[model samples]
Target chain A: MKIAVDAAGGDFQPENPVKGAIQAVNENAHISVCLVGPEAPVRKELEGLDYPEDRLTVHDAPEIIGMDESPAQAVKTKTRSSIVVGLGMHQKGMVNGFVSAGNTGALMAASAFILGRLDGIIRPTIATFFPTIKGQGLMIDAGANLEVKPEMLFQFGIMGKIFASDIMGIETPRVGLLNVGEEKEKGSETLKKAHQLLEALPSFVGNIEGRDILAGNADVFVCDGITGNILLKFGESIPEALQTLLFAAMKKNQIDGEQKKLVGGLLKEAFAPFDYQAVGGVPFLGVNGISMVGHGGSSPEAIKNMIVNAARMAEIDINKKIITSIA
Target chain B: MKIAVDAAGGDFQPENPVKGAIQAVNENAHISVCLVGPEAPVRKELEGLDYPEDRLTVHDAPEIIGMDESPAQAVKTKTRSSIVVGLGMHQKGMVNGFVSAGNTGALMAASAFILGRLDGIIRPTIATFFPTIKGQGLMIDAGANLEVKPEMLFQFGIMGKIFASDIMGIETPRVGLLNVGEEKEKGSETLKKAHQLLEALPSFVGNIEGRDILAGNADVFVCDGITGNILLKFGESIPEALQTLLFAAMKKNQIDGEQKKLVGGLLKEAFAPFDYQAVGGVPFLGVNGISMVGHGGSSPEAIKNMIVNAARMAEIDINKKIITSIA
Candidate 1:
């Protein structure tokens, strides 16, 4: 299987993406990577790196879509940009999947414009993986469509269920509607209507409250893009806040250096689950093909994990299962 | 100078309320407490407690509103319930304010029904106090009105600004619209419209994301009740989830008892800001009179803090300021 990497995208540019591509190709025997970017810099970064010559290759795409550019306009105008070109390759079936640490909005726009949506899918969604007490859960529409109808939410549940079952290896994944309260009568009018639709599904676990997000109440939690986006960002900020508070307390107490180190290590271990880099990238579900978007500040290790995740999705044929399920 | 306490409310019932009332009256020289509940149990709980006899008294309120009862129906039918009787006292000018750890919906209903809304107030919001890195900030409409219009959000800003300046002592409070993104064009349709409305206000600081809740980005964050309610509950659950995770890790590492106790002490100190009981209660903003509501599981200390908060709100005459500002 072949995966395309948007080397010119993200804050770190070609360095992290090139290094990640090399690592992904070396680690996965069945997968090869095509690094897409301007040829000169891409080749220059690959000079010191050692990898199997046959497994790794470069696809030259000169134009670059900036992070600050308007997503729709950028995607439309920057036709030869790495993001558009990489996704275009996936559309043409040259690569099974694509991964980028680029502008999220541009990636979503390019994906929807180039690859289009799956059959019976009204809109594409961004599904983020969250670490729960038991293991991991997926939250869909994590900033894709801010204002969603009740029908859209019902579709999110279906798509989230398929992704969890096929890629995450959860059988009959429990789907939940994210709301303020657990009761059916609670939440907005859209949620009230969606609650009825979701309840008809066999795997539906009814409404899950915000407290239930970290409590591991369900396998797939579905909500509108606005709520999901806010939740995802808030969850990401927890570890940093805790770290600042803990260190401040230690300083105020005048703890010994050795004890401080021990406590720091314990706190790091405790907060490992909250690290965004550890989880790699989140997949944009409901798109026609496999597409994953990582954080703009993703490290080489995080990029590598994202590549592996994309490869896993390609291997599992998640899109096919989603298409079948949504039908 | 007098505040009514809902003695039959909260999980601990008459005991916590009675103890808290005693603590409040004893601590505040200018404040008097009127415990509203069934005379028998309330007096029995107060018998052993030592307080200023003249400053503390029990008012007979025979009916009790259960936590699970419907808010509107209960408020209408259970006219003699503690929540109703307590707020009625405030309505009748017998008390300056009222505090309850009872059913939040019922308290809200009774407050609105008995005390009514301030002039030009579209809706009475529930303003919750959140401990930020730089002291505490307030979030308005934290479950009072789930679905609100753009005009109502504008009013919320006025109310939140007045409450912050008059009660919180922030000379010029920064107001923010809670949204998915910081860009003016981002978020739901209602948020986009609300964004334009908030921008006209002198204190409006543009949009604030969910991560800003703990970062102390704004003095007052405004959102619809559903989003605010979800954010509040999710914020409340963080420390509990962290505690569960931290203890599991300690047990796995087989830490000694002394080390465990020391670590626990440090963690507790670090997490003290997250404890709702520490902050006391949140006030129901925009009402004609001072009304505060605590968590259903509030302890005696929490109850005492709620009474003190109510006294502070009453002392500042927050409602009059809000009325003047909105007008």
Candidate 2:
């Protein structure tokens, strides 16, 4: 199967995507990659790279989307953009899936516009993998739809369960509704309604508190994109801040010089585990096509891993299984 | 000055409160404590404590509210409960402030009903102290008013600012409207309206993302309790989870035992500077009487610190200052 990578996406742009695509193509024998972006910068970054020509091809789309630009405006104006072109390839069945680290809004809009929502799926949810002590937990609706109903949350639980079982290989993954407290009556009207609906669900673990998300309380933690997004950012940003502080303290000799280095290194390392890049891209489920959106700060290694992850989703027929389960 | 202490409140009740009240009497020259709870158990726990009798009086309120009891029902049923008696003392002007580690809901309701909302304040907010790197931050409405409008948020901001400056001793404390992103246009309609309203206020620091809460990005972080409750619990829970995991790993020798211990100790120390014990009780701003709620996890030291904090609040006439400043 062929996968399309948006080379014009992300903060590092052509270099990370180009290097990562080449690496992914080299490693995965059954998968081929079509890098979509401007040929000049992509090729320059690809210089001296030893990649399988048959498996690695470039599909140039000169236009790019800016971070600040409105997603709706970009989709309307930048018809030949890399994201749009990549979505086109998936629509035509030229590629099995598409990946981008670009504007999240644009990716969601373009993917939904091109491939449409899967059967029985009203709106797609962003599924991010949160690394926990019990293994990686599937944190669904990380930043897809802001305002969601109880029905949507129930759907998120179903989709998250499938993602965990099929992709992460967790059998009967425990589903937990991320709430302020564990009690069903603890949350807002939306949460209370969702909790009642989730109780009837198979493999439901009841309401898990915010603390439980990182504590590895459940294999699958589900919430609306708004709260999920807030939690995701809080988890990501805190560790980043801690690591930075640890480094600064060590550099300034604010802590015990020799002891601080050792302690600081370990603290930093512990904090590093929570970083977004280490977990790769969050897959946008419920769409007809398999598409992933990596963080803007992701490195080549992370992008390469995301490519592999997306390929595995295609290989395991995740989209088909999700569609079947939801239906 | 007279202060009422709920001797039977908290996870480690009677012992902590008894020892704490004794400690407060010993430490404060002019302070008198009225320990409210069941007489026999409180006396049994206070057996070893040595303090002046005139300063330490027990106002027996035999009934106690369990942590799991419904807040509204508990308040309605347990009329002569320790928490209620303590709140009543505040209302009667017999005590300058009331301290409790009892049911949060019961405390909020009792305080609101007994003390009544200050003029222009609709609902009483539970302002909690947040442990931040650059000192502690105040996040009010931590879970008081779940569904909050821009008007309520504006009041929260004003009260939070007043508490920060008058109580925490931070001048011109920066106030932030918690949102998904830093952009002004980001977040829901309430947030946008709140953002605009907050901007017009003198101390408003614009929109702050969830990640910034722990980084000490602003002196006061404001949000609706639904979101605030989640964020506050999220912050408190993550560190607790990390500590648990770290200790578990250390116990199994899965990591460098000595090094891990040392780092843990340092983090415990660095984080100690902002521990709840040091911050004492969260002042119930916009209320007639000075009221603070200690955490159930608070130790004897925490209780003593809270008494001192409450005394300081009384000394500075925080309530009068806030009323005038907002007016």
DockQ of each: 0.67, 0.46
TM-score of 1: 0.97
RMSD of each: 1.6, 2.6
Writing each residue's lDDT as its tens digit, candidate 2 over B1-327 gives 778888888898998888889999998988888899999998888776689999998988999998888888888889989988888987988888888877777888888888888877766787888877777789978888877788788888988998888778887799998877788888778888889888877899898877787788899989878667777766766556666545554555455657776657655655454455555677777778878788888888888877777877777887777666556
TM-score for candidate 2, residues paired by index: 0.93
lDDT tens per residue, model 1, B212-317: 8788889898988877787788888888788777777777778658877867878788888888876778888888999999998888888888888788888887
Give per-residue lDDT, candidate 2, residue A183: 81
Those runs of model 2 whose alpha carbons end farther than 4 Å from true positions after fitting are A244-258, B44-48, B244-261, B315-317, B320-327
- Residue B186's lDDT within candidate 2 is 81
Return the top candidate by TM-score: 1
Each model's lDDT:
0.87, 0.81
What is the TM-score of chain A, computed separately for every candidate?
0.96, 0.93
